[model samples]
Target: MELKRTNVPFLLSLALVVLLALLPVTKTWAVGIALLLGAAVSNTVPSAAPSGLGKMRKLALNTAVVLFGFGLNIGQVISVGGQGFWQTAVSLGVIISLGYFLLRFFRLDGDTMKLITFGTSICGGSAIAAVSSVMKARDEEIGVAMGVVFLLNTVALFAFPLLAGAVSLSPEQYGIWCALSIHDTSSVVGAAAFLGDTSLSTATIMKLTRTLWITPIVFVLSLRQGEKGKLSVPLFIVLFLLASAAASVLPFPVLFKSLASAGKVFMAAALYMVGFGLHRSVVKKAGAGGMLFGGILWSVSIVVGYVLASLS
Candidate 1:
């Protein structure tokens, strides 16, 4: 009976993901609606949700990211990645350095500080999740980190495009800005998608380059802590690159296009799971200082990123 109860929510959630995927919703709307739906379901029957739901969410997201590669041009990826490398490295260093001072100023826990910093500087929840494993962070700390990032990412999704328009940024400039500044690949791509295809492509490639920084960061932390956690490029990123390479050579235009479209839907589905996982308790536990630190750090990152994007 307990097993059956758990299965019901899982199946229902799956159906909802598929249903939403078929709708003609924009990326922003899909993410927003899916999050609301997940929150509603989780809040209504919180206990009935499966414990493995988070893992499933990650799997869905990774798969979607890999599929997204099918749409990219290998030459473009190489060009964008090359251009963004130094900018990404410098940005990461600055964000982490500022985060350290803020950590001391706020008197927050070290583990939470690292988690938030990684999320802010790298790839939002993905960075937090990766670092948490090596750092052996408590569930609560991870929750707080993710919750803070989530709130900020949601704000960026809406505000960034409007900001870009107000500044009269070209699509390419907006793309670089979004890739440099935004928290997650999902949010970055979503915000850039609002601008146009050029923005979308540029943001995706540049953000993926930024994400590559996670491997070295995680590896160094693991060595320092003597934690033998798995150290490698995230599998999804490798697969995404492979898919891009194959798309460049393989003559599967229709198939690649379909997969890319499916990837967006799956990404939206993952957003739903992300929302469902962030319970109110977690948000409350994020604390005022943690929230302030993340918000302030993110704001500074935005300004710095925009400057770099303009100069680049």
Candidate 2:
């Protein structure tokens, strides 16, 4: 009985993961549910919630990223990269620069700023996870960053598809717009899939191209950390690349797809754990500045992306 009592949080978290897997919702919904559940449980049953979930969060995040590689088609990513390299580069640069200026105006902590910026400039949750591990960010900071991204992602998932018609965007144009504007690959894919197969394929390739930037940016961030004697590249990043490469070469489509799906499940579960860290104090620390920064940056990204896509 005592053992079960001690394990309620873990068991509840596991049940949430299973529930997420059974639901036919978008990644955004799954994460939101898990986060809300964790927050509620923490407030009501604080004793059941553990003081630390860092190890599990990090492990789950890394494993999910590596497995996500299985869903990539290296040829598609390469072709998209070759063609849209400059576009992505310019967009990322613009967003990062904008983020730096926004930081001056906002009252967020440095780590939170970096997390939000990287997440916005690149691939939302995955970018936050990768950079957070490198910086050894606080659990509260990670939760806050992800929460901001989550809110925006939920808005995008619903809004983009609706706006596609308003903007008179063709499937190709909408796909490119979604790739550039949406923060997460899952959300981008979800939004594009609503348009049709052409949009889905284009968005996936373009989003994957953006994901490729994760390696270089993370490497640069690691070097800048100046941990003089401990300058080792993260193993998960390497494995993520290798997994993509193997997927490109291997003929086991069924297996790879299954792994990728499992990765999504794990990511949802990890996000639920991330929520456990979000108490009132953490949310307060995140401040209105963090939310504003995300909202403004995402708005700019949407407008710019729309213009670029229309031109293309």
Candidate 3:
């Protein structure tokens, strides 16, 4: 029997993972694969929980977040410390605020704008995931936000390195730029390594600063929900923070490396899920103008990131 379109995405995830595993993209990009699988499983898995694979999706996302620390050493994150922390806070405010303004200008209504603003301003996919859980955003809003970030992420992946090379930026400067501007950790690494190891280290430090804001950002959003009415510190947010701490304390050479590697696989899967979740019928209802408006938000935000980086 032919599989449904939903099942097709899962198959594609499996095929891509198998094929790409032979290429050089495996270690970190594996997270993208895990994202794909997660998205696919969420849509396609049957209700027969015993026979289904949906549980893996959650495991993959959690593992991906924890293992992500391996890509960034705790020592490096701490070394940058105060300055890195401040820069992250400032940049985050700038990006998210810019997103809210531009989205409002687009005249986009309701929750879609909020999620998009949060996603662009915070840490890309992770921001969307976290905010969605806390705000109880509808799936349509999540899809729109993901679609916007994915497009911009592809652009940042290519653009940041070329810009850095053209300007002849130092490893430190380029690293800080990548860490602050790029959408996610994987993209940051690609942009950083485009420069060198020193750039990678510095970029990861910058990115770590951004990750730390995830907690505060979520807390702020939870409050905006007027938590006094019914909101509180989300369990998932706490879970995310706890996962980070555990990763920092875990000891061992080989096992840690493997867990870290598993984490990458999960991230890959999550990203793939983002792409596969696209539901054209629903987004199309928002109209072409809606898409254009989202694009404008991203375009303006990129300019904001570059201008701020130049100033720094």
Candidate 4:
């Protein structure tokens, strides 16, 4: 059989995984490099080149999150989450309220405004995808929102760690700030991991908690728009919690360690996929006004979250 052209991107991605695995750099660096490579190459290929990689990306990420849970005990997850629940809730409300007002001030159309608001206020593309359905957003609107959100997320992946160091934030503080400020779960975990393993765990749990807000946010949107929207939960979170519970009860030190290590590698690969999905045309279509709106909200979130975290 002749070689299929569609498999080229997949093969390239797999080769990247192998090369990065052999590098002496940290896993976070490997992932960052992979992301850069993916973004650089994304514009060169057909739009369809990366389409098949989405499922692989999702599976890799879910597996990574579940495996990462092996490093935690359920109690730690519960305790940290409970302590920060009020802070997270307040931050979410602040972000949404401010984002809505600012987008309107910028005079963005309703669909675009809602897309950017949900993307920034919640879990980036996932939030956009969920709320767009309820709002009956056009395809172009969804693309624009996702493009803007992903671009900001990329900025956060690099900028956040530098900000953390400049401000001398503790790992816990950095993690909480990442959860509150970053646009997506992958970027949140990536930025936190750059800080250290403790920050990674804290950020992941806090980010997952933030994701739970998706259901309620969608519900509110539907109520206001008089449109029906199905609530979709990321089941991997349930698995992550279950894995933490199992780790707490089981005597599998070697097994847990192995899984955690593998999970880090999987996460790096997932980040690589994320970077590959970035398309310049889509970002350009998002328009400068939408980007400015997202930037304003994101900047405020980082500043507000940092202050709250420092206080707590």
Candidate 5:
């Protein structure tokens, strides 16, 4: 198939992601630098270019998750997921409760409050997008919420590894902490990617498990708002499970290793795309109040996750 001109940037980004992953330098540093490069150049790129690139990015992420599943047995994934279940549940509860009181105390606009609450408590921008539709939030409210989440996601990508190192956390500990605290799947996966392969796998399973909460959260929100809300299931998770099952049952070590390696490359590429989506215009639209609210909530989540990880 002939590639379109619009696809050149995305293709180049993918190639860079793969090359960085393969280089002799530290994997974590390579990924981090690539992410920054993408974010820096995002503003100069045509806005229309990213719409198609976004779809391609999601496809790459799903494929990567499935392939990465080959590195773990199905049972291990289940066990790790089970351990993370409570963390997700408790973190969601805390965020909602704190957000409720904080919103009242701050007397923020209702729609903006809801947007921040959903974005912080669930899967960041995806949750904000889903909940806003049901709540009939204004474009400005949605934009602010998304901007807040995106900004925090960027911060998390850079800060998490440094914090993890300072605390001397194990790979599993770092993974669980990331799943509990990070605002988006992309950020969670990106932060953990630098830690190690084991960290990446654990974080992916935990983050995906946390993502499943979207259905129940949205259903509850819809009822409260007396409006219809759509639930989006991350089907890539099912594919991930299937891949793990295949790895457990099938006897193909060499093939599985190759698939897992490719998965890492794809993951790096997906993160690069994520970085590319961050722009200053979005941050400006978020406004000071929205940024403060999101910042507070995100900070609390990080503390909670750290405490939980330390205790575990």
Candidate 6:
């Protein structure tokens, strides 16, 4: 008889990630919840799933990005009036630099640390996925990095909203804050929801500005990795632009709205796959060291976010 590993633990982590994403936290210490949840789930599988599933995961995250467009308005995204743009850019650069150095100081492996840091400081789980594929990073490295981002993403979602209220920031300012601060579109949207529909609308624009950087970042990382080949960017990115354009020009609200909703569904499926495939042992073996490095990376991002928001 042959024995097979079912990957139950990994599945558990994937489910937890999705749940945290789905929830809207405000003034409830959502960060703590996200931390616990991220810790609880992930690292369950003995190995990566089949290639087909990997493709599915990639599709889901891309769809999530697209659906994200529906959550915002085209005109407002254009009229952000250039406040905090430099602040966001500067803060992002600083955070990446600081986190990268810190990880090396702690003697972590460079590639894994870079992937994790880039993932947390830039977009979130999605960025990590794109970079991992482009650079051919180990699955374990990707998993560990994503787990940390998942934790901080939740924290940003809940805590940022409360802070937004406390400071009484305007929609433009708050949108910039959310755009620059949170790691994922989900976190950005989740945090903005606490402020109201309009914040979600404006922040989406601010984030799109940041999301555009992923391609160039991937290209540079690929070059350094010597992972460069033909180096054509993903087709989905092209589709994402088209979707955004359609959202911008389409006169009918319903069309744009449906496109956005489709994006969310794909993301949800991706979340499910991540949860279902995780393993308990992998998470255990990840050790305190890896997660700690991820935390430091996340912290640097948060500080950068604050500076950027203030300047904006």
Model 2 TM-score on a 0 to 1 scale: 0.67
In candidate 1, position 107 carries an lDDT of 77
Per-residue CA lDDT of model 4 for 1-312, tens digit only, reads: 233677587557657774784466755577677677677667666542444577878788889899999988899899878866777788888988887677547777777877888888788988898888888899988888888898999999889877876886799888988998898888888888888888989888888888888898888888888776566677998999999999999999889978877787887788778877777776788789888888988898888888877876
**Over the stretch 1-312, how does candidate 2's per-residue lDDT look in tens digits?**
234476587666668665775577654356556656766666666676554566776687678767877877767656765766777787899888898887777777888888998898899988999889889999988988987886677678678877878888889889989999999765676577567657866776677667778878888888888744234455875686688788889999999988877776776666566556556665565567778888989988998788878888
Per-model TM values vs. the true structure: 0.89, 0.67, 0.65, 0.93, 0.91, 0.68
State the lDDT of candidate 1 residue by residue for 1-312, as single tens digits: 135665587568757766776776544466666766777777777876676776878888788778888999999889989999998998999999998877667777878987999999999998998889888999988988998898788778778977976875778888999999999887887778777668878888899899999889988999889876455777888899999999899999999989988887887778777767657776788889889989988988999889888886
Alpha-carbon deviation at 196 in model 2, angstroms: 9.1
What C-alpha lDDT, on a 0 to 100 scale, does residue 37 get in candidate 1?
73
Compare the candidates by TM-score and give the number of the best one: 4
Index of the highest-lDDT prediction:
1
- The CA lDDT of each predicted structure is 0.83, 0.75, 0.60, 0.82, 0.81, 0.62
- Residue-wise C-alpha lDDT for candidate 5, range 238-261, written one tens digit per residue: 888999999999999899988987
- Candidate 5 local lDDT, residue 294: 87
What C-alpha lDDT, on a 0 to 100 scale, does residue 13 get in candidate 3? Answer: 57
The window of 10 residues in a row where model 1 has the poorest summed lDDT is: 1-10
TM-score: model 4 vs. ground truth? 0.93
Give the Å shift of residue 296 in candidate 2.
Answer: 2.0
Off by over 4 Å in 5: 1-10, 47-50, 227-232
Reference-based lDDT, residue 259, model 4:
84
Compared with the true structure, the alpha-carbon lDDT of candidate 4 equals: 0.82
lDDT of 4 at 113: 76
lDDT of 5 at 215: 86
Residue-level lDDT tens digits of model 3 in 1-312: 345555654665565764553356464344344444544454455321222343444454455555655544555556754567777777777766766666545666557777766666667777788888878888877877667666566567667767875774678777877777777665675556567557765765567567767777777777888774333343433454454455567766566566655554454554554434433443555456555755665665566556555665
Question: Model 6: C-alpha RMSD to truth?
Answer: 6.0
